[model samples]
Structure formats: C-alpha cells, structure tokens
Target: MTISRRILLASPVLAMATPASAQGDWPSRTIRIIVPAPGGAGTADNLARIFAQEMEKRLPQRVIIENRGGAAGNVGATAAARAAPDGYTILWTWAGTMATNPAMYSDMPFDPQRDFVPVVLLGSVPNILIVNNDFPAQSLAEFTAYAKANPGAINHGTTGNGSSMHLAAELYGQRSGTRLTHVPYAAPAAATTDLIAGRIQAMFNLVTGAQPLVTGGRARALAVLSPERVPQLPDVPTAAELGMPGLAFGTWFCLMLPRGADPAIVSRLNALANEVLADPEARRRLEGAGMALDGGGTPERLAQYLREEMASHAELVRISGAKVN
Candidate 1:
C-alpha cells in the first residue's frame, strides 16, 4: 500500500485509542471519600459506609472515608476541592455546604459549581419543627400564635448559620409573620443539648438529630416540614396541613468531585452509589434513620438544583438579614 493510504488507516485507530488512553484504568489505587461532616452523623457515616462497601465489591480498588469537619463543612469541602482531580478524592456532603454557605459567608475558598462536579444525589430527610415538651405550645398552629403574641421573645435553636435547619426556621418565621429570635450553634449536638436543657424553646432540626430527645419525651415534634407526616412521627402534622402550602422543605446530601475529573470515573462512582441505594437492606437501614435514598438524575440536574437554591435562598437571606462571620 502507498504511504498516504497507510497513514489514513492508522488515523482512525489513533483517534479511537485517544479516548481509551485518556480514560485510563480508573480506581487503579485506593480512593478517598471525604465526608465534610463528622463520622458519627448518620447521613455522612451511612452514605460513606454503604458506598465504600459496595464500591469495593464492584471497583478494582478499595474506597476509604475520611471525616473533615468544621466551618460549616467548608473545611472539608475546601480540602476536597484542592485535592487532585484524578477521581481519587470525592466530597460527600449535605446541602448546607453547597447551597446555603455562599449566601451566609463572604469568603468560601471554593465555588460549589465551579470547583466540583456533582456525582449523585445521595439522599434527603424532612426536618421536624420541634420544641421542648415543657414549652407552652402543643402544635405548629399554637406555636405560631404564641410567637406572634410574643414577637421576638421566643428564641429558637439551629445547627448553624446557612444550614437547612436555620433556613427552615427562617422560612417558618417569614411565613408566619413572626420575628423569632435565632440562636446558631456549631453543630446539632450542642443545639440539642440546649434544647433539652430548656435553653432554647424550639428548633427545626433533623429527625436523626432530635430523634432521641423526641422519643424520650425531652422535646415535642409538633409539625414536619414535608407535605405528608413522616411514618416515624405519625401524629405530627405537616406544615402544608396547617394552611402553609409553600413551606415544604428537606435536607439533602450528595456526592461531588472536583471539576475536571474524568466523566467515566464520575459515571462509575454514580453507578456504584445507585446500586448501594437500591439495595433493600441499605434502604431499610437509611429509612429507619429517617433518611430516604434520592439516587436520581445526572450530575447536571444536581448542579441545576444548587443554582436554583442559591438564587432562592439569596432573596430569603437578604430579607431575613441573617449573617455569620
């Protein structure tokens, strides 16, 4: 064959090899999944454990989970962003870090959209609006009435600034037309301690965060944030049932990787996550803890959700005038 014909034949083969070359054998080494929250928390720990176990079974190498908490999840998220984008390090975090932090803080070292690619939406849980059992109100309606009568006299607790707990409480006040006093803490553990001690009368916190207190009669969950009552708290009504249609809210967690990671690797991670979420045993464990798996659409959908949330919460934060250092 002539030299030109030989060169043409090799061009297609070279082009085909390029993609295979770029997509090199992924998970050739151990992968680190960074949990922005501490290891003890149900959402972070559960997801990390489940995914790591399943990924180990499916992938070529082991997956490890590391806890890096502080600064409302910024410390760990920032660390994940700075890590190499070779699919070795992943950031598994809740919505507070990606959706609410930008509006609350002036300087976050990494941008949620710019610095990372969404792998999959792991799960979401409806937070319950609860108060110490000794508080005056018995239900959400009563609580609203009491707050309106007292105005800024009622102090409420939340996990921290820019958390779902914080924003949910703000939304409740905004809709109810009451200016409830907000007390922010570093984490739910501290806030729960205060709630049990009667230091704060109310909190719109995670079910897992307040489950013990509620079960033990230390606090009363008067209303849930979902449209329907959670199975765990059958007696409590939803916010929508109390004449509030637009007040539905939930806390969600997702896995994200630094931008520029290979698409093949992202796909592999998401697929492994979906399998873990689909497992009947895993689903039972998660739901038993008040969390539900949300293994849905592509990473693009998650990115869109973040953008919409950023826009939606920006307006609310401006109106609420909630600020943090």
Candidate 2:
C-alpha cells in the first residue's frame, strides 16, 4: 500500500480515540457551581455550600459556588444553560428554579427540560404551616376553623409572588377550604420577622427555616407539609394526617449540567454526589437542616422526577393563578 493510504487509515483510529482521551482528565481545573440564588442563610444556599465542600474532597479539583440571585433564579439558570457543555460549570438549584419556575413564569430565559442534564437530586424538606405566637388558633384544626370563620381576615405571608412558599400556602388553602389573604415579601427572613411580630397571622415556610422559631416559641407549627411527620418535629402532624392530603409539599435541591455534556462525566458526578451524601456527617448536617436526604440515583431517574414535578407545579400555578412576566 502507498504511504499516504496508510496514513489515511490511521487518522480514523485517532479520531475515534480523541473523545475518550478527552473525558479521562475531566475536572482537571476548578469547577464552578452556579447557585441561582443570592448568598444567604437560606436552605438552598446552605445545601449548595455543603455539597461543594464535600465534592471538593471527592473530586480532583476545587469546586466553587457562585450566587447569581435575581429574576427568581433565572439569571443564574440562564447563564448555566448557555455555558459550554464541558462539565466545568454545573447548576446547583432547588425546586423553584428547575421545576416550578418554568410553570410560574411566562417568559423563561431557558427551558429546564431542553437545556440541562440532571446530575443528582441532593435533598428535600417539607414546608411547615406556622402562625404567630399570639394567633388565636393553636393547632391545624383550630387554624382551619378560624380561617373558615373569618374568610379573608387571616393574612398569610410568603417569600414572593410565585415562590414555593406562596404556592404551598395556596394549595393548603384550596384543599382545606380556607380563605387566606397573601402578603408577599422580598425574602423569607422578612416574612419570618413579621410572623414573629404578629404583623402576619400565619405563613407556610420551609421546615429548615421555621424550625428554630417553632422550637424557640416565637412561632407555632400547626402542621407539616409532608406525607408523614418529619423527625425534627416529631410532635407535629402532617397535612395528610390532618385531612389535607393535597397539602403535602416541599422544596428539593438538585444539581445539573448543561445539555450535551459527556455522559461519562455525568455518571461520574452522580456517583461522587451519592458518595458525599452517604457520609454520616454530611447526612447528619443535611438532615439537621430538615432535609429528607434524597441522594438521587441514575441521571434518568432525576429526569423523570423533574418531569413529574413540572406537571404537578403547572397545575398548582393554574389553580393559584400565579404568573411572572
């Protein structure tokens, strides 16, 4: 054979070997995790920080978290979606950004289903129905009765117009046949402050955020928004046990990479994440923050879970008539 023909035959083998060789040294440089929310004491932010700390130990390179909080987490999510699908930039976001925002916002910058690949679902925590200490009702039953008796008199506070807290409260009202006037706040801390000060009658907040107040006697937890009671609040009844089965709801945190990322990298990240979650100290810290600890399985499982959540949130959005431009 001619020398040129032999060289041509060798080129095909080199081309086939390029991709595998490239994926072998993945994450050699620093990896960035874009958290689509502001840096604060929020559960989502804490979860991101914890996971980053654990992942850096497991991975070869440093993992950094960047808070791009604005437009209801769209700013960061859009940035992540547009990032190169090279596994260097991953999006660590919660339910609002991935599952609920698409249904709540009319104009989303990127489609969650189309632009991202699920890595793993880190954890979840239920919402707790809390009221100011001086509120007349002491339990879920009394609270419902009070709400029904005084139709629009009871005021409920939420993080924002289309936040998970807002939708969960709406679902609670719809299922329990209670009427509540919603008062939206810029942040949950603000709402929490008002709840403790008796400015707002009641609020549905995450267990992680509300647990301290409930334990300190500043606020009272009427019911937990989970199918079964959470361990942190063993005395509190779930919405299902209180005759409001539809009110079972919570927020979940997840990690994802931009679409077209290498499948090998995706699998590696998933395995590493599950490994971090398996650590006893990590699980203790996360669970102490009220997380249910759902370290996800296969990437396909995360995809399916996202789909189910999207559909469920769509119905809630429709019922609550919530929308953002």
Best by lDDT: 2
- lDDT tens digits by residue: candidate 1, 127-164: 78989878999878898899999998778887666677
Q: Candidates' lDDT values, in order?
A: 0.74, 0.80
Stretches of candidate 1 off by over 4 Å are 1-24
- Per-residue lDDT of model 2, residues 177-263, tens digit only: 888999999878888888888899998888888888988888989999876688888999987788776677788788898877777
User: Which candidate leads in TM-score?
Assistant: 2
TM-scores, each model vs. reference: 0.87, 0.90
Regions of candidate 2 where Cα sits further than 4 Å from its true position? 1-21
TM-score of 1: 0.87
- How far residue 15's Cα lies from its native spot in candidate 2, in Å, is 20
Candidate 1 lDDT score at position 107: 79
